[model samples]
Target: MTPPTGRPLPFPSGASPLPIPSPPALPPHPPLPPGAGGPGARGPGGAGSTGPAPGWRGLPARLARRLNRVPLRARLAALTAAAVALAVAACAVAAWFIVRDQLNERLDESLATYDISPRQLQNQLTACSGGVEVPSPPSPVTVQIVTAEGDSCVGANMIPVRVTDSDLTVAAEGPRAELGPYTPEPGEFRQGTSADGTETMRVLVRPLGGGGALLIAQSTASMEAALDNLVRLLALAAGAGAGVAAVLGLLVARGALAPVHRLTGAIEYLTRTGDLRTRVPVEGDDEVARLSRSFNAMTTALDASRARERDLVADAGHELRTPLTSLRANVDLLLRSERTGRTLPTEQRVRLLDQVKEQLVEMSTLVGDLLELSRPEGERHSTPVKVVPLHSTVEQAVRRARLRGSGITIDTDLGHWYVRSDPAMLERAVLNLLDNAVKFSPPGGRVEVRLRHGELTVRDHGIGIDPADAPHVFERFWRSPSARGLPGSGLGLSIVAQVVRDAGGTVALAPADDGGGGTVATVRLPGWATGGDADAATATGATGVSGAPGLPRATGVPGVLGVPGVPGGERDRRVPDGPVTPIRAVTPARPPQPARRPGPADGRGEGTGDGAAEEPPRS
Candidate 1:
């Protein structure tokens, strides 16, 4: 029962309303009348749509979606087949219509050629009842005569046509007057169905200059037959063509999509095995080849990444083993002594404990350094970089080095320089350089530190690095043969190089100036603005460097290093006899160039951060 005027009545609990059947789906739009809608209602696009929709319209969309779900090979084949079928169908339809029209036109022209003189027609009619000479129009043509009184008579053919008003009018007007108003011109042609209505006929009524008109007609039977044959031939050819097209389309699609198949297989294999080394073969410069190349490049990158990760793991294990083994051995000894109910000497126990502590610290430092080096620049220092003060960073580094190198004397002549760099990374890089210098210096030997403009130089009075073994300083886990016994890892300079490169700078190692015995490390950073003239500041700054034999004054401004009194790059041409600052150009996995006598400073020569001359590595 209804509960309220506007509210529905409630049913019993657990009862449901009757289900309503859905109506059948309808077309997107209703059948439109000709000229009933807008401009879209007619023309080539609207030809088929002018009538009610076909039954297959709804099914085609669903069928098309299903077709699209098929494999790419099948889809390509189908598309090619459809295109060819369409072309063949269009040409067939066009040819059929053209031939039909041409045949009908020839039939009409044939009808026009039939003519009979007015005198000959009258004579033939006069002799018609006597079975005398009757004017024969043509064999397949049927003729009729209309008298002045609208009477009809058969002329030379078996079939006779009903005389319409137009014929009667032509008769009354005497063969010379206009045939009828319906005719376009005098003696113009007309087409009508034959008496039996089985075939088309071309009709022409001409004025005979007498009291009647002559009607000439021809049967279109032959033309119709010819048209029928043409239609059948066109349909057969179209069908055969479409079939061949389907086969060819499949073949072409297969050949064209071969590369795609290979790529798909490669991707599937990669997915199944998690192997990044799988690559699609590339063979040509086509689009498919380009895609293959891109896939190859991606796999190559992934493989390289995996290799680096493996190497890092292996190297890390190797590095940690020494410290871990020592720590374990010492702890085991302590445990052994306790278990035996015997105590080691106090001094020895303290030393053993100290060694363990040192190992722990070293391990901890190594792990920290590894973490720092492992991350990308963004993750290593998440904060955005701003202009940093290089002078202060150097000062801080020097202080840290002082604590590490107690027996070593440190000298500094830092100039005010500003650069765009991560402050923490810059400071760390400087500290690494300082540490390297102090570690290599002889006892009581002086380590000169100088910062002029954006160039920072750290020189140590130790055995100079051999020219032949100089290039591997920046490779991860690489150590110099002479430095392997030292109590440090080889990652310090590598870290320095990574930081400097991130900050858009360069770092180099060379021998002390003028053959001074020791190694010198130099760093060059960009974006520097200072109050002092760059050239003047660098020239005066030379005072900070100990045992620096005076080279000819370089022609460039201060802070620019080259031979003295020589043009830029030309100093490499003339060789000096004395030992000069070792210059090195460091690149990844490449050997360093040894410093030789200063010659022309041609840019082509391998120049290092130090004012040293050398040749580039052979390719």
Candidate 2:
């Protein structure tokens, strides 16, 4: 799953010809995808054998993964929205609780805030004790009290409750709820209830020191109406606050991410122009500025790589001219001779024909190398890399080099070793190294091959390259001034470096620091294996790595090669870093290459990998 990338780049070693490192191993996966294990069924760690260990189990990571699949802009917006909504909701709930408590507490406080005495209440009670009960409004807050004389009640209007003999008896023992200044005394008060059911009686009762009692009542219709209004106002405020907060939050989010919006527009502009040089005009040096800087850096790097690519092509064209010129001349000579009825001696004609064949062969070799150089990037050959024998492959490569070179003695101190790689690719890489050793070695000087573990070092005792030239040695078509007279296409080491990478190995070139100076190229590989099985890769080379190294260890079964050369149709026989992200391209397919300079990244691109730019585990 592709997640939002944070735009941090890991450094790739520059100029040193360092090989790509192998990736870390992955832990085992979980048993049955979630829910595949039935309810109550334990995971492998929990006693079921079908899952990963318990300590490693958790939901947050999985949730992150799930969320990562979401578009970053949308994901961030959702997170912000959810946070704001929860905050506002919590505030609303708290406010509701606070308001409710206040209303209830205020009502209770009013009931406790009275100063009327029991004696005054008794006098008032006595004034009406033997008379018939007066009618009153229903109590907004229920009011009733027990006095020494008997139990009595008042309604909202400071009148009496519906005191039927039975109701009076029942209410004498019960007050529905307490409210107001429940003074025991008959304070300045009024009893009233409008016909429409408003209740306005505030009543309080107190017992005298042992036997006496008093009751008082007042009308509270106005206060009840005021409190009711207050409650409605509070409700309105709560609703308004919540609505305002939600709206404000959304606006705030939009404002905060304004830079991102601007960046988006700039990116669109760049895409339309197909120019990475276009950049967002940065504001303050914030994360957005950092992002802009990173983008610029990336583009600059890409530009440099592009520049290098152009140089490679130009250099290749220049080197190609010679073989092509020779081939054309020979062909013309043969054709012209055929047209002219010149009865040249049979031996002379045979010689001319042989010359044509030799020139054609040379042209073919040059063309092959050119083709290796021309293979495009994003080719779909994501192949698995494995251990390849160093000794044998180099030996075969040494013999191959002999076929192409003259008067070169091959020397070696070697042992069987294997590296993670494709055999065809690894073999080509070694061959390129051998070719370079032969080309630069003094006509009769020895070219030494040393293999230890998975490292192969080739050294020649000839015109050693300059330190300055060493930097550009593996660059396509690069050559040294000291070696101007030497016959070379300047692509051998480039192919060497390219294929080494595909095989998940590193290649380095340096002038022999030893008193006997010459150029030394070293290739280091991973997935080193020991023993007889490695013969398939390295034993074929000269002064071969031979000894009793053990048996080959098994890696997984390799898949079949699809289209071996084309990137789009090429199967996973090249890149070992899993499947390529995009399986297709906008293409004029890879251009045809002249077939001669055959060292590999295909030729390892491990392209140009498993001959040009491919890597070991990464290819």
Candidate 3:
């Protein structure tokens, strides 16, 4: 009875929904083209109306695009030519107007001041009254006489100019009394046509002394001819000038862009050949020369980077080969015993396994060092740098060193110092320095660690480094001949150097200044005494660490030992007379043990191989 719940109740139980009348369908419209609604589209009147014309509106834009396709030198030449042409055309037009004005002024002056004798005028009037032809003047001037009653007469062989009301007025007034030798009589000058309507003339109307007016007229045909000739000459000159300008512009553009052309060629050569040795020749002190010099410097740097890359690869291969070979040999020995049904001694088996583990650890350390060196210099500090307490970082490193070298004694004398740097990186650098000293120290030998102002020194009483080897100790993978037999990857000092350099500090190794038979490593960093403003210092992002009370700040000068702002002289190196609170000596974890020498199980270390006898110290 419910009509299946969702069937619209059977259209309201057979009453049926009233059929909704369908609207009539209209005609369909054709699709419009792309951009039909844009500026070029039809107006509201649809197909019958028009929108703005695109042709003239887009002309300048279209022309600009075409011009852009032209080469730079050609564009420069064209612009120069256009500028010169415009200038020449303007000058020509101005000169033509000036000359026309000058000619017209001369003609008007001569006509206005023309002399006429009274006797000649009387004879002309008598001839005109008797209806006889008046004699013409010697020149081409047309002379006529008009009476106050509007009667006129013309000379024989002369053109009669049309008379107007102004002439009649002049005839009735007689001659003007204001006439002077330098000034023409009062009259009006006008352009008029001959009575026969065949000639154009310049007419001047002047009243005669007795009773009528005289008209003087001249033809303008010769003056027009002269002006036309001048136009032709000026146009020719302008055309010639424009042509010459275009040629000179092309030459100038070619010469000025010569350096740019050479630079482009060098860049192309380098790109095609993958060579960084290509250098552009620089000449003059212009912008182009500076660009060339910059290009040369870039190539030099790239070449050096490539050289360093090659050396690192070769060194890494050499370092990895020894550990891998030893591991393979040991594995094969174990596999051989098992396959041959031979039982190996337990002690020997355990010892070989321990050796394998140690070698793996050594290989792991070498790989980590390689990865660190391979990272981009900019990405060395993965975390934000901050103002770090230098003394605390040194204490942490010394603790680590004591743990590593239990048989050695490390004495620390640290002072309050703060430096802006990545805290972890700075600590790692200090630890490496301590490790170097610890590695070289003999059993029960004391290692003195001291920090004052912003300088840190670590001294060890061991066989001193050879002066010849000191220069190369910080080079990657360089192990001294004497230290080659010890266990090390030879990258410790290299990493220390990189970190210290990035922190805007300096590190160096030299024989003990006290004449002790050991090496002393000194690190100098810049910083101010006291806490100062931590936030301000962090914002400044200075590389050097701060100094202690009563001491001048380290100058932060790379490889420079002198402290800046010290009165009179460089700060003395002695521990300033302050309470020297020496850290209690750390007890040895085990009885003092002699240093281990390299053996077959030790492999040859990361940077030392059987063939690396001449290598420098890993420290």
By lDDT, the better pick of 2 and 3 is 3
Number of clashing residue pairs in every model? Answer: 24, 90, 10
lDDT of 2 by residue, 23-112 (tens): 122346767776455655575544446666666688779888998897555555566656655675676567666765675445445644
Name the runs in model 1 displaced over 4 angstroms. 1-61, 123-138, 146-151, 161-187, 207-213, 384-387, 406-411, 420-422, 438-448, 459-490, 501-522, 527-619
| Candidate 3 lDDT, 540-570, residue by residue in tens | 4433322212122233212123243366755
Candidate that would win on lDDT:
3
Give each model a TM-score: 0.69, 0.53, 0.69
Could you tell me how far off, in angstroms, the CA of residue 205 lies in candidate 3 after the best superposition? 3.9
- RMSD (CA, Å), candidate 2 to true, equals 26.0
Question: Candidate 2: what lDDT?
Answer: 0.50
| Better model by lDDT: candidate 1 vs candidate 3 | 3
Model 1 Cα displacement at 514 (Å)?
7.2
